[model samples]
Structure formats: structure tokens, C-alpha cells
Target: MLLEGKTVLITGASQGIGRAAAVECARAAANVAINYLGDEAEAESVVAEIRSLGREAIAIRSDVADPASAPAFVAAAVTAFGGVDVFVSNAGICPFHAFLDMPVAVLDRTMRVNLHGAYYMVQAAANQMVAQGRGGSIVAVSSISALVGGEYQTHYTPTKAGVHSLMQSCAIALGRHGIRCNSVLPGTIQTAINKDDLADPEKRARMAARIPLGRLGVPEDLAGPILFLASDMARYVTGAALLVDGGAFVNLQ
Candidate 1:
């Protein structure tokens, strides 16, 4: 009920953290709009699930990396939901590869989707919120990788860092408009995105053991923090980088 009568727009809501956050937001009484690419069946299923929760939901297929599509996505949601109250920028991709052998295409695509996509989406959402004359919340799904380095995530981590920095700067720029911008820095969460990387049982267990929480995270593990940041409960919180990493970031021994 934290978001009763509110409206939330989420990018890449067809799966993983985005999918869980969308459902959780609906449970909190917010009508939802989801943006996805490539998977129509999966995206529509999420729409069906949200509708089942007695909350209005719509799924639009748009390439977040397409700069123009960002405004289109936000405009469609605003038209359907009347106004936008919360925006979750969560569309991203991670293609693991050695830094020395990294291909230009992979790096380009990663940056385009992870960092550029987030920027476009956030900008459009802020414009609508400003026009509405009502304060709004923006939560970008950054990653713990933003705070640290990764053997195979050289390209991806920088984009995450950029996202975190975007929130910090935007928080300052939009505060006068009553718009809050923050980011969630997630740790290793088991999802389709990294399924192949963790395919080996031994490798997966080793990764989990490094975390203080004694286990890996799931998509749902991040929903609460996201909801908190997007709700009135966090009205005083902005320009914050929340680490939803199962305490993994500080477990160095």
C-alpha cells in the first residue's frame, strides 16, 4: 500500500530484477508500465500478472538503446497512466569476456544499452515529472560492479558506474523540481543474464561462499529496496547509492 494510487514505469521488466520489481510495485498498489525488447511472450505475461493484481499494467516493446524510443516509452505510459510517479531504469546486458580480448562491438553494445539507455530513460521520465508539477522518484539499477572491478566485466562495470554517477548528479540538478534520483547497486544475483557464467556447480558455490550472506541473491531480493526508494518512505533519501549486495562488498579478509 506504500504506492497506493501511484504509477510506476519500469524498463526491461520482462525478467530478472526488473520483473520482480514490477510485480512488487503492483502489490504496493501502484499501476505499472513495463518496457521490454526482444521477448514478446515474456513481456505480455508480466502484463497479465500485474493486471491480475488489480493494478493497471501495460507492456511496450522498445529498444532502450534507441535514444528516440526513450521518450516514446515514457509518453505512452504517461498517456495510459495519466502521470508518472516513479521510474525504474533497469534495462541492461552483460556479455562476459576477457579484457585483453574484448571485442569493440561487445563493448559498444554494452555501453549503449547499459549506460546510454539509462540516461535516455531517466531524462524522459524527469521531463514528464517536471511537467506534472509533482515530485517524482527515479531509481536506476546500478550494480556493485560499479564500486569494484570484475575480471570479465570491464565494459559492463564502467557503465554501471556511469549510472550511479548519473543518479548523483541528477539528484542535484532535479532537487528543485522535487525529483529524486538514486540507484541500487546490486551484487551477483542468479538470473538468466549470468546463468552461463554460473553454470558450473563449483564456480557457483565458490562465488556464493565469498558473500557474507552465505548465499547468492535472487531478483526478488532487490524489490524491497527499490520499492523503498520509489515510495514516500524515501522522500528524504536522494543522491544515494544503495548496495544490495548481500554484504559481499565488505567481506574482504
Candidate 2:
């Protein structure tokens, strides 16, 4: 019960990594604010599962990419859970295209949702944590793409790289206030992001060959690390980027 009695707000909690994080928070005995931008039914189902675990949970609709939406989200979480102990910025989009032919719209949407959304959401969440006058944790879901540039994922890479920079800068700025900021960079998780690619046997095999772990990552695989970073287990950790890539980031022979 590392996070017993803590409250965590996770965006994009309707499915994939975000959903897994919500369940992990409950397992850690933390009440959860599950935020989703769409698929209300799925979000509600997640809340039900959390409650079934004997922890408080609620679904809130929010578009992370919208500037006005994050503060409202924080306000709703404060109303429900007294205040936030952890905030996970998990909502993002990936639209891959080669640089030459990449559409401007794809770039704009990727930057808005992945980078700008993280900035504003963290701002709002930190405001709440600061006003509470208690130390808090902030975790952003960055990508391994931030570390190693991927081909055809140009639109996706820049935003994730921005996230790493954001985490470091925010951690330094907020440390004195007892606030910690960090990012988790995952590689080739078996989520909606890689569904289309994995559908192709060749692409899947190629990806597996690169991963020393011998398999693609599951959303559940990321849950543990995220929970640890959000809990007191990682109290001394801030201004760090933990790569949960199953050796994908390492040059393992």
C-alpha cells in the first residue's frame, strides 16, 4: 500500500497505458480520478472496476489538448478527492509520416496534444498541489522516441522529446515546493499506437528482433514503474526519465 490514501489523476484513462495506470493506482490503495476524452462507457467501466477494488474512482471527461480543459479537470479532482497527490499526464496522439510528405495538420495535432497538452495539464495540476501546500508527484508519459528518433514518426518524436525537456525543467523549478516531476519513456508497447504496425507480421517480427526482452511490451508492464514513481517509494526521485522499454533503449548484445 505504498500509495494508500493517495489520489491520482490519470488522463486518457479509458484504455491502454492510462487505464492500466488507473488500475495499478487502485491496487496501490489510491483513489483515482480517471480522465477520458471519449468513450464515456469505457471510462465508466474503469471507474466501476476501481470501486470494485474497494477504492474510490470517478470518470471525468476532458480534452487534454484544450487549454481551458485542464484546470477544469483539476478542479473536478479537488472536489472529489480533497486534493491530488499524483498527476499523470497520459493523453497523447501519434500520427506518423515521413518528413517530406508529412501533413501540417498531423504535425500541429501531434504537437498540440502531446506537448502543449502536457504543459497546460501539468500547470493546472501543479497549481492545485501548490495551493494544497503538500508535496506532490507529476509523471508524464513520454516515449522512447524522445531518446532514439524513429523513422516515419517525425511528428511523434519532437513532441516526446519536448516532454523530456519539460520534465527536467519543471522538476528543477518545483523541487523546493516538495513537488517532483518525472517522465516514463516506453518503447513499442502493445497498445493502440502500434496496432496497425503489429498487424503486419514482418513489422512485428522486426520490432521483436530489436527488443532484447523477446516480446512487445504490454500496457500492464508500465503500471508498476509508474506507480512506484508516484508513491513515496520514489520520494528521492525527481527530474528523471525512467525508460520502461524492456532493454529497447539499451545496446544489449
Candidate 3:
């Protein structure tokens, strides 16, 4: 088991990539602390599944956007699993809106959930890890949108970019403590958040055609990379933005 005896805390873990990562971590023998915002049932389901795999799991209700929620949840995880060895900041919101038409509230909400939330989580997790003196890994779930402009994601892109920057900065600051900080930038993964955009067959086909891999990624596709980053395999890696985009970024078309 790659993560045997490690405790991993994952935010937005009720569904999609976050859920997948939780399952993967459990499979690797890591006790999981799954955090969700509103969906209690979904969160519980994940917890059940992890328990069935013979790994300890707990469902924590927390809105990462809330300033206090990050530390509170971290403390909760500590109470449950001793300490956090890995923190995956996967909670985020992406609302598509043109720049000119984007409302102030939407932009602010996006920043609250995506940027500020990640910052708080990282800070809290780093503090906990440092206190433990065992070092740790922090992986922010970023997006390829951070590297390229999105016609409908003017506000969303910046938050991801900010998250990427946050990881890089933390990598430098936390290295002395033996903590590693990095990010995983997933491309067009079919998740509930983007279900509508992908529901249109024409739109989906067009999007797939642009990717060199000829298919959209799934939540499971990103789990391995995330697990690697959070495992001892990446002991020397930090300040990295790994692209799990299926070659979409390099597709000239």
C-alpha cells in the first residue's frame, strides 16, 4: 500500500474527482476524512464505500469557503485519525460567465470558494503538519483553464491560476519543514459541475476532437496522479503544476 497508515483529508469529496481520490486513497490503505459542503447523503455514501474497503473514513460537513471551516475541519480530522499526513484542496466552484456579463456577486463567490478557500485550507493543513513535525503533502486541484483563457470562464480561470500560484509559493515556504506543495491541473473531466456543457453531444464531440487523446477525462483518470503526488513517490517533487489534460494543452488544433 502506497499510503499505508497515512491519514488523508480531501475537500469536496462527496463527488467527482474528490470522491474518486478518496476511494483511491482508501484503497492505498490511508484513512480518509471526506469533507462536503451540503450533500450529506453523498458524503456518507463515500464514507461507507471506504469503510467497506476496510479503511477508516469519516464524513465532515464543511463549507471550505467559510473562513473558519478549514481549521475546524482540520482539527476534526486530527481528532478522528490522529493527524493529517496529506491534504488535498479539491473544493472549488466554476461558474461560466462572460467577462462583461459577469456579476460582482458571482465573481466574489467564485473567489471565496476557489481562491480564498484553498488558501485557508493550505494554511491550516501546513500548520498542522508542521506541528506534527512529520512533514506532509498538499495537492490543490487546479485546472487547465489556469493556463489558457476560457471564453466563458473569465472569473473562474483566475481562481485556478491563483491556486497554482499559492501552491508554488507554499512549496518554497514549506520546504524547510519537509512539506511538499504541488497542484494537479485536470482538463475537461465529466463531472456534475460541467454535466450540462457535456450533455450536448455536439459540444462534447467538438471538445473531444480538440484533445489529442480523442476523449474527455473521467474522475478516475485524475486519481492516480493525485495519489502519486500525495505519496512518498513524489518526495522530491514540489512547486509543480502537473497537467492531467490528455494532451489537450498541446493540441495545435
TM-score of each: 0.99, 0.97, 0.99
User: What is the C-alpha local distance difference test score of each model?
Assistant: 0.96, 0.91, 0.95
Please give the distance, in angstroms, between residue 180's alpha carbon in candidate 2 and its true position after superposition.
Answer: 0.7
lDDT of 3 at 44: 95
lDDT of 1 by residue, 99-121 (tens): 99899999999999999999999
Clashes of each: 0, 0, 0
TM-score ranking, best first: 1, 3, 2
Segments in model 2 whose C-alpha atoms lie over 4 Å from true places: none
Error of 3 at 187 (Å): 0.6
User: In model 1, which regions exceed 4 Å deviation?
Assistant: none
Looking at model 1, report the run of 10 residues with the lowest lDDT sum: 38-47
User: Residue 192 error for model 1, in Å?
Assistant: 1.2
Error of 1 at 136 (Å): 0.2
Candidate 3 stretches with Cα past 4 Å from truth are: none
Task: Give residue 136's lDDT in candidate 3 (0 to 100).
Answer: 95
Model 1 misses residue 108 by how many Å?
0.5
Candidate 2 per-residue lDDT, tens place, 66-131, comes to 999899988888899899999999998876678888898989988999999999999999988899
Can you rank all candidates by lDDT, best first? 1, 3, 2
Instruction: Residues 1-253, candidate 3: write the lDDT tens digits.
Output: 9999999999999999999999999999999998899689999999999999999999989788898998999999999999999999999887777898799999999999999999999999999999999999999999998999988899999999999999999999999999999999999999988988788999999999999889999999999999999999999999999999999999875
